[model samples]
Target: MRDAVGRRTFLKRSAMGSAASLTPTGLLAVGAGQAQKPAAPSERVRVGLIGVGVRGRDHHLRFLGANPRVEIAAICDVDRSRADFAGQLALRGSKRRPLIFGDFRSLLDRKDIDAVVIATPDHWHSIIAIQAMEAGKDVYCEKPLTLFIAEGRRMVNVARQYGTVIQVGSQQRSDWHFRRAVALVRRQRIGRLKRIVTHLGNPGTTSGAFINPGVWEPVQTPPEGLDFNMWLGPAPYHEYSPNRCHFEFRYNLDHSGGRITDWGAHHNDIAQWALDMDASGPVRIEGKGGFNKAGPYDYANYLEVHYTYGNGIELVCENEHGNGVRFEGSDGWINVTRLRLDASSPEILTEPVSGQDIRAYDEKNKSEEIPGTDEHHNNWLDCIKSRQRCAADIETGHRSATVCHLGNIAMRLGRKLEWDPDKEQFVGDAGANILKDKPFRAPWRL
Candidate 1:
C-alpha cells in the first residue's frame, strides 16, 4: 500500500466487493452500468493524437506509444513539420506507419480511432473535444480544460450526452502526495478548514518567469510549414507572430487566461478537491494584478485573487506565494507541491487515515502500475474500460477551470463580484457576466 492511492488504492476500493451480476450466483443487479470492455488482449486500441507540441509529444505520444494495449493510429497537427515528426515517432520500429494528418477533423473522421489525445492550445480544447466526442471517440484533453467558463459547461453536457469518457489532463489527481493530502482533509485531519493559499507561479511558462519584453517583434508572416490560421481555430484571427504561438500562447488573453488559467488550473484544482467543491465554486471573488500593458504578452505577470466560498472559507490565488497549495484550518495546516509535502505538525504527515475515515473520493478498477503522465493516461483508460468516471472527470475539470476563470474575471474587472455557482453566472453584473464567454470568429461557435 506504498503508492496505495496511486493505483493500489484504486484497485483496493474497486475490488472491495462485486455486485450480484458479477458474483457467483449471477443475479441481475440494479443500476449495473455498462462499459465498452476491450474485446481481446490483441485487439489494441486505436488512438489518434492531435497537437504534437511540447505536451502532446513528450507526454501523450510518448506514454500512449508505450502502452501495449494502444496503437498510435494517427498524428495530426496544424504544423506540418510537427505532424510529420510525430508520425515518424509513432511509426518508429513498427511495420504499420501511422497516418499523418494536417487537420484534426480528418483524424476524427476515421472509424478506426477509439480515442483521441488533445494537447492543443487552450482555446481549441473544447471544440476539438466536443467534436471528437460527437464522433464517438473518448477524449484525453490537456488542462485548463477550456478558454472560457461556458465552454466547460458545454463539454460536460456533451460528455454526458454521448456517454464519452472525457478525462481532463489534471495529472496531479493521480499523484500519491495529492491523493494522501486530499484524504487527510476529507477526514477532518486538518480540522475545520479556514483558508487555502495557492501559488500559481507565473503566467508565461513552467520556468516561473514571463518572456522578456521587447525581445521579439510579432512576425508579419506565419512560419513555413505551420498552418497558423488553422492553429488559431475558434480564437480570433491575429497576425501570425512567433511570440504569439506555441508556449507563448498562454500569455495571450485571446488564447489563454494568463497565469490565472495556466497554473491556476492545476493548483486551484487541488484546492477545490480538498474543499470538496469539485462540482461548485466560490460565491464572491476579486483581485488585482499588473498586466503586460504594452508588450507582446498580455497576461498578468504578478497577480493575486481572493475567493469567498459560500461556507466562509477564504481562498487566495496568487502568483507570488511560491509554488504549490497550502491549506489552513483551525487546528493545523498542510502544504503540498510537486516536490514536497509539508505540514504545520510533522504528525499530520505520519498519521494514516483508516478506511472508514478516508472519504475523499470513491475508488474503482485495479489498473496497471504507471506513474506521472503515463499513470494519468492509464487511469483514464482504465476508467474508460470500466465505465467509471475519471480521477479528473469533466465536471471536476470544469469546476476547477471555473475557479480560475472567476479569478481572471475578477482580476480584469478590478472589483468584487458575486458569483452564482448554481446558475453559473455573475449576480447583476452585466460586464462581469459578459466576460463568461468569448465570441468566436466567423464559422466558429461553441
Candidate 2:
C-alpha cells in the first residue's frame, strides 16, 4: 500500500517542476491574461461559495450583504439545506438569486463566476483552492492555509501558477491592534526582540467512549440532508458521526490539527507576522504533551512547543494561560489578544506612535483605528478588483499554519526536529518527514 509521502516523490517526478514553473505571468496568460485590460470601474464581479457551513455562512453574509461591486452567483455545500439557506440569503432582496449545488465542481463549471470563497474543513482547503484557481477563479480560503506543510507549499505554487488572487483568512493580520503591535516591535519601539510567548489555552481531551445521539446511530445511515461522503472528500472515509463533522472536526488529528492548528492559525499567525517571518519559519520545534485514550481523536490536549529562529528569537506556545499573544523585546514587551494590549511601559500602549517609529517599519499608514475590517474579507474583494495581493496571501498563511502543524508533529513525536523551509521537510528524521503530508482517499486526488 502506498502512503501519501511516497506520492509526493511520484508527483515531483511526473510533474518535473511543471507545477513550480506555473508562475504568475504564465498563469495570467492561461486564465485571466486579459484581466489586466481595464474594464468599467463599476463592472460587477460574480462569486461562488464552496462549503456553506459555519464559516461559509459568515462569508456569504459579508459578500451578499453589502459590497455592491460583487454578487454571490453560486453556493455549494455537502449539506443541501445549508447550501439552500445560503442561496436564499443571497437571493433575499436582490435581483439575482445564486444557484445552489451539492458538488463544488458544478459551481466551478459556471463561467459566470469569477471567484470562490472556500470555507471548507482544513483537509479540503488545498485541493479545492487549487482546482478553483485552475478553473480560472480567485479564492478566499479560510485560515491555516493547508492541512499539512507540503500542501501549503503546493497551494502557494498553484496560486502563483494560476495568477489568481488567493487570500488566506487569517483576519488578525488585518486587525489594527495586531498590525500596530507588530509595527511597533519591528520599529524597535520594543528594542531588540528577544522572545515571543503565545498562549493558546487548553484544548482538553475528547476521549471516553460515547455512542452517537439516538437520531444519528445505525452506523450505515447519515443524517438528514447531509452528504457525509462529499464532506469527507480528500480525507480517508470514516463512519459518519456528528462529533467528527462540522465544528467538532477540529479536535481530531486526521481532519484537523486540534487547537494548535485551529486557534494557532489565528494567534500564532500574528506571532509569525510580528516577527516578520512570513517566508521562513522556526528552525527547530519541540513538543511536550499528553493524550487521551478511546475514540478516533488523537492529538495533544495540552502542549507546549518551543521554536527557535536563526535570529535568536524564541517562540513558545503554551497551553497554561488564556488564549493570547505576547512579543517580548529589550525595551519592553507588548501583549495583544482578542481583547486588549498590555505592556511594561504604560506609555507603550497609550503613547501615540510617532511618525519616525511608523516609518521605521514602513507602516506609515498604520492607523489608530482598527486596521482593516470584515475580518479581512473586504480586503480580498478590494484586491480582486484592483488585481493586487490580499492582506494575508497564501505564502503568509502557509508559513503560519506550518508553525502550528510543526508544533503538533513535534509534540506527537515527543522530540526535537530540525526543519528545512525551502525543502519543507525534516532534515534527518525520515519518520518525521513522513508526517509532512497525508494520504488522500481514492478518487479524491489533490
Candidate 1 Cα deviation (angstroms), residue 121 = 0.3
**Residue 180 accuracy (lDDT) in model 1:** 65
Query: Tens digit of lDDT per residue, candidate 1, span 1-446?
Result: 11224232343344463421111110011011211222233345678999999989988888788776577889999999998998888887555789899899999999878899999999999989999999988899999998999989999999877767778898877665566677777777779999999887743232363333434674688879999999998899888888889877888889988887888888899999888898999999989978777787778888889999999999998876567888898889998887667889998878755434443422331132223535577667666555467778899899999999999888888999999999999999999999999988878866
lDDT of each: 0.78, 0.73
Error of 1 at 408 (Å): 0.7
Candidate 2 stretches greater than 4 Å from native: 1-42, 202-220, 354-372
Model 2, residue 349: distance off in Å is 2.8
Task: Quantify how close model 1 is to the true structure by its C-alpha RMSD in Å.
Answer: 7.0
* TM-score of every candidate relative to the true structure: 0.87, 0.84
User: Candidate 1: where are CA atoms >4 Å away?
Assistant: 1-42, 202-214, 354-373
lDDT of 2: 0.73
